[model samples]
Target: MSILGVDYGAKKIGIAKADPTGGPAVPLTTLIVANQKEGIERLQQLIASEGVELLVVGVPVSLSQSGAELLRDKDHLNKQMQEVLQFVERLKNTVTIPVELEDERLSTKLANGMQKELVKINGDDAVAAMVILQSYLDRKKL
Candidate 1:
């Protein structure tokens, strides 16, 4: 089954896709939306066209210094995390496919590092999505 990864944001969302048989995820594109509603609409179209069977969304979580546990309380999530959770909820409600959340702590920093090597790169959001998706794929192997 093909899997799609998403790096969600208020304005721009990063997209990545993995092969049906399971392999490295590749950066797809960044969707620039005016609002969450528009983003979901665009995602619906992309999901249908790509024949995505699963949706993986990256959720930013505040981590402790040791990175052993989450730092934020469940009842008091940060603003960004709250927004992402809301978006995920909306996504789950709108799509028929299963939705999964992956912790994306330093995915953006990693993507930015990758940008330094490439002369021309798409938005960092797409790269971040690739990072998130790749991390999920790697963990599944273990």
Candidate 2:
């Protein structure tokens, strides 16, 4: 089944796609939406057009110093994390396909590093989505 990776943000949402047979994910595009409604609507269209079967959204989670334990204190969640959770909730409520969350601790940083090496990078958001999706694909192999 084809999979779509999403690096969602308030204004810009990064997108990436993986083949049905499981392969490396590639940068797709960045959706610049004014609001969540617009973003979801565009994502629905993309999902239909791309024939995506699964949707994986990158979620930011706080980890302890040891990086073994997850920090789930709602009160301690940063604004961005809270917003992402809200976005994920709305996405889950709207989408027909199964939605899964993948840890995206340093996806953007990795993407930025990649951007410096590549001459033709498809925006930071798209690259970040690629990073998120690629990480998911790699983990599935192990």
The TM-scores, one per candidate, come to 0.87, 0.86
Q: What clash count does candidate 2 reach?
A: 0
lDDT string for model 2 (1-142, tens) is 5788999998999999999585689899999999999999999999999998988888787444432343356456789877887787798899999887778879998888885644156888888888888887887761
* Angstrom error at residue 67, model 1: 16
Worst 10 residues of 2 by lDDT: 62-71
Candidate 1 has a TM-score of: 0.87
Distance from true location, Cα of 54 in model 1, Å? 0.5
Model 2: pairs clashing at backbone N, Cα or C within 3 Å: none
* lDDT tens digits by residue: candidate 1, 2-121: 799999999999999998585789899999999999999999999999999988888887444333354335457888987887898899899999887788989999898885543146
Cα lDDT of candidate 2 equals 0.82
- The best candidate by lDDT is 1
- In model 1, where do residues sit more than 4 Å from their true spots? 62-74, 115-119
